[model samples]
Target: MAARIILNPTAGNGKAQKLFELIQAHLPNDVEVVRTTGPGHATELARQVADQEDLTVVSLGGDGTHHEVINGLMPEGKTIFAVLPAGTGNDFVRTLGYPKSPRAMLDVALYGAERRIDVGRVNDEYFLTVSGVGFDAEVAGWVNQHEKKGNGTWIFLRGILRHLVHFQAEQMTIHVDGAFRSEPTFLLAAGNSPYYAGGMKICPEADPGDGLFHVVWVKDLSRLGVLPLLTRVFRGTHVQHPQVKTFQTEQLTVEGPPNMLVHADGEIVGHLPVTMTVIPAAIRVRTGRS
Candidate 1:
């Protein structure tokens, strides 16, 4: 089968270009390489290639680019997506146990086994990893708007601190599997994969193939309350905290104050009052041996 690689050279502080070159060096000599020129170009390229050619389509960029690529290839198509993880967070790639190095990642892309994984749906939108609303979405919005123009964990730190100072909790009513939670919350995340925000394992026990999605809700916290738990989240241990609640469901609906911020896989999608569900094994993923 033909293999097509869509490269976004601007990803990961422009290091995606170097990764693209390395991927080129290791790919089978017959594979075709296409460079994306600007935002959303990678998705367009991926969809076009998937529709017109019987080939494996690879996305070589960060989570946003990967997000776009998945949107381009959903709902029972023959095209298979493999990620090269050449972006800042590469969170979903990490979830699949792929190495960070370009050569190592390409080795899997070249030889990895194929597996079926779940993809999430909000209204009709697709999210391979997660969809978040409330406080974290505010953080994501701030990060995208004011992020330091460099590559490092500290940049995210600064962004979070900035958002924390001004972020406000919202009254939300969450309905999961017929259970209701009416509370003031800092954040609510529904995940198909286990992590978001770089590599923070927001739902540590999540399994994409389980035919269920996981949700994490952070209750209203004081600055003091949220701080100690922040480290726990990065360590994938925040679920142990009392103010944090985790649950699983096949479907959920969230209604919040009007004009609430919404994010899916780190990109702001729209305002709140959304319905989300898990579509069991809805997509075919190129994964390594289990």
Candidate 2:
């Protein structure tokens, strides 16, 4: 059994490096380890072993690292994936139900049950958590460019507050399954598993095994209404608001102003005019749950 740990030492503003110390003593004797040098390096590392059927590739950083790993493994990977949450937004690990403790997470990574989950594709990029556009995408781009001083949700909240006051909602055309409509949109998040921006359940009903995306769309909102609705998103109750709508689909499309930013798993992938589709049971993974 070959296993490799792809560690992103700079993730979580050095938090991953600190967490590595605790797990260092617990890794298997046979496990090989490698550290990522920069952005997209994790993907390059993971791709090196994606074709090994008997191998397990563990990601030991934040969601961004895991996002890179997933992109590397997708479409043809036979290796089992594992994650240890060591970053600001451990959203993917949250959805995986991994333990919060270092030793426990390591245990799950090394010996947990193997299962399969869905993968999401927006244009040519793949995502394991949520892919979003409009307001949230703009916020993601902003957060990526500045200093990351706080925890995941707090950081995202700060970015949201920075833009929410003056952010403008743009008109967008949406297509789900076979139906189509156009509306003023504040944001739209396509979720494979229900969580993003650390803990916000943007698409609360998304199920990775169900072969469908739980798409959440927030229609145009006034500044006052947007903030209140966003507050409820942490609890996933925002879906109940009149401005929000949820849909389940295997495929969808979003067409809007070309400048509208699009993000996959919190990392800005590109702009809008994207087609997102669910790839069912696309990758194998280790999880604490059966």
Candidate 3:
């Protein structure tokens, strides 16, 4: 078997390209490296290679790249997937217990345990980490428009602070499994992994292989009240707060303000009125610990 590496040169502010060049000599000779040109290009490249039975398709970028690759390989689950973190906010790799060193990550990609993990689908899009609507989605929109400088955490913090000042909690109707709740929601996160928004631990108990999603919703909090909850998110203690609610389910639907944005794995997908479902053991991935 051989490896097909789909690299996004623009990810991590061009750091991905540099890392690949630095480690090119160390990679296996049978590997084929391909660089992505623009947004959604990784998906196209992945789709082109998904039918190969004796090949492993690896993504050498961040969460967005992984999300794209997963979407492209979906509905056809024959291709094996692997990831080497080379982008800012590599949240999906974090959930998989990936090492920080590029060499170690690459080693795992070449020889690691294969595990089947669940995938979350929002409308028709697939996400390996987390997806949400409202406040965090607004922050994602802000981060998308602004030029990022320095660390990803700092950039996201700046975006959150800037948007919080003018952000309004949207009225949303949420249905989980069969239960229903209609309220003013600040943020609704359905997570298949434990981390998002640069290691925030928004859904600390999420397990990608569990075949269920950890759903969290924040409601009835004033703007100032949200600050303390945001702090708890870093420690993953926000779920204990009174205004926050957490549950697990296989599916859910969210209806909110028409203009409210929705984000999947940190990339803005579309507006609200979205339905998310879980596909058990949807994709096979090479991980640090099978």
Write down the TM-score for model 2.
Answer: 0.98
Candidate order, lDDT descending: 2, 3, 1
Candidate 2's C-alpha runs over 4 A off are: none
User: How accurate locally is residue 140 in candidate 1, as Cα lDDT from 0 to 100?
Assistant: 78
Across 1-290, the per-residue lDDT of candidate 2 in tens digits comes to 47999999998888888888998998888899899999999999998889998888999888889999988888775899998788877888876777878899899998899999999999999999999999999989887876367777889889999998779999999987678999999999999999998799899999888999999999999998888888888899999998888989999999999999999988999987999999999988899998
Q: Indicate the worst ten consecutive residues by lDDT in candidate 1.
A: 146-155
Query: What residue runs in model 3 are displaced by over 4 Å at the alpha carbon?
Result: none
Q: Who wins the lDDT comparison?
A: 2
Better of 2 and 3 by TM-score: 2
> Candidate 1: lDDT over CA atoms?
0.79
Highest TM-score, which number? Answer: 2
Q: What lDDT score belongs to each candidate, Candidate 1 first? A: 0.79, 0.89, 0.87
Number of backbone-clashing residue pairs for each candidate, in the order shown = 0, 0, 0
Decreasing TM-score order of the candidates: 2, 3, 1
